[model samples]
Target: MSGETVITRFAPSPTGRLHLGHAASAIRAHDYARERGGRFVLRIEDIDGTRSRPEFVAGILEDLAWLGLRWDLLVFQSERLAKYQAALETLKARGLVYPCFCTRAEIAASASAPQGDAAPVYPGICRDLTVEEVTARAHLAHCWRLDMAKAVAITGALAWHDAIAGAVVADPLAQGDVVLARKDAPASYHLAVTLDDAAQGVTDVVRGVDLFAATDVHRVLQALLGLPVPSYHHHPLVVDAAGRRLAKRDGALSLAEMREGGEDGATLAARVRGGDRLATSW
Candidate 1:
């Protein structure tokens, strides 16, 4: 890699308290930035207004501080709607995105295979909507979905560098049409994250391995939008003793709960850095 200063970010949705999994991810991102004398950013993914809460956002800040992980800059997705809108309009103008009106049940019924780890691959029911049909459905609440085929056609043969996997070809077709914007939220995670990473000059994306597959979609978006693709480092997830992935539902493992129980922040941070054998359960 070049000797340029690396920039990484720990972006978490403020829907729940910071759990052990979140702590581990943050520690990894922060350490990566610090090791290279670079910058670490904290991004609040609060696009889902219905689920996101101010209290949760406050808890996230307090937890990150207690964990001894400092960020060089902080950004909130809720504050960047206009940027996402402009990107969406650009895609629409290029005929790379269309409105999707399918509900959860409708999509589930349309899916051909058993739902995999990620959200069921969106069947392209709305991809072929005619201008008049789209005009009629324009009044109804709908989500803007990227036409993966057209996008791939526009930017043929894409790839991204990964620290673990090396150069990997991006296969966004597996994801089908992904929602870029929703009726309730101005931007979906795919659109918001790709744009934010570019805007913040994130050179390295360090996150859970679960998101490795999603990188394909993001890479395609980067190519379509003319944004730079960052190198990725997909780390293993923190799991409980039973090997189950840590989740927000495990309230006892939340950083706030640990702090309230008189746990040392540095000790917890060290444990997370050391590996999966945490002193506390997960």
Candidate 2:
């Protein structure tokens, strides 16, 4: 990392408008890059065709620009679907990923421990499906999942560094055979973001702490795809009056509303970056 130009990114999904939580993440990454004479990339993670909207994308740009943050480069995950597919193909070639035939209801009902964003840790039901079993279910739609146990055996023990948590050992199994590809989407978030970070030469990953656990899965993907792993800095998420994490579903105030309401973007950004909860109050 010595003498290497620091590169950090604010990869936001365009499913909704940028909120104060989004601003905190952007400011953290923006300031981290700018303070060290490095490049800051603004990546739009809109791979989910169903939720992502052009209006939200436009609003994201407007909000960031209003914050006075200039990105050195811009990237859209939707445009890089081919690259992600190629990576998934590479993993497929290595026998790393497999097709999962389980449905949402079956998974939810069977899974005892859930890991991320309400997604239950997969119980590996389809992990050892026989060739005939696969053929039997061939007519059904399916998604791709990593063969976690085999992947770990091939990669051996894995580890990475975090700016906040210090040295960390990766435990990909904790998440269970995570998804690498979806039926509608060519690639999953774990696979796409990890490849993008390496492809863009990102040296530091600054995002909310909610994604900290996802990093374990990302690290494993990095090793499997032979991608460079970057440093991570997971900051606390912005919460509301009830102390719940700010979410678009929760009607967390959007930056667009703030801008229209005449709240100073710079002032709010600074307050959030300073760990001031009052910035989101009112």
Candidate 3:
């Protein structure tokens, strides 16, 4: 993307309050673009209707603003369900995806092997169902799964670049037929994020290293949909006092709490930008 404006984004789910880890990530993404005279976008990954809250959304906006971070554009994945559904339909129409009627229990029970820390690799149990068979189970809840073998065959060998890891080969099959969408949740993260980055004209993706492997699946999705491939920079995740990654589910202290406790948002952001202390002193 030489000569192209560096476009980066910090897409976070509004399930909980932002923590220092989030601050570091947001600073990374924000600084990456601002340093390059580019633009930074703030995207809310709130497709999980069961967990997303408007209050959290408001809190995220407030926290970032308090950090002196300004976004050129704002995006919400919840608003683009139709676009994700259309893309999933495109894959289904092309025979690149199929309806999976298997429940979570059945999938876990049938997993041939685990793919690292990811959920059990789907065994494609419903991959061979006939059109009539699918129609027969019309009442059954189902999700869309990419036909990994077919998809990879159609796309051939694919690859992507990471600013930290450098050249990497695409390996979506390693993850099996990942869910693209479900009846209850029309847009899956893999599908929505891949589509959103391309649609938003993101040139340089900046995020935590936890999603490094997920990039492999995203690469295949990008190739299948013929989306422009953007450069990636997967930075190390922020750690807490325990030297373990902080998570909202783990009840990590939030930026809101820190700000209320008299911590300076801009000072913390500046420390993050300077790579000061993510482990003990933060």
- For residue 52, what is the lDDT in candidate 1? 96
Better of 1 and 3 by TM-score: 1
66-93 in candidate 1: lDDT tens per residue? 9998999999988899999999999989
Candidate 1 matches the true fold with a TM-score of 0.96
- List, residue by residue over 61-87, the lDDT tens digit for candidate 2: 999998889999999998898998998
Model 3 off-target regions past 4 Å?
113-117, 278-282
Backbone clash pairs for candidate 1 read none
Task: Tell me the whole-model lDDT of each prediction, alpha carbons only.
Answer: 0.89, 0.89, 0.88
Which regions of candidate 1 deviate over 4 angstroms? 250-252
Pairs of colliding residues, candidate 3: none
Per residue, candidate 3 scores C-alpha lDDT tens digits across 190-232 of 9999999999999999989988989989999998898999999
Q: Estimate each model's TM-score.
A: 0.96, 0.96, 0.94
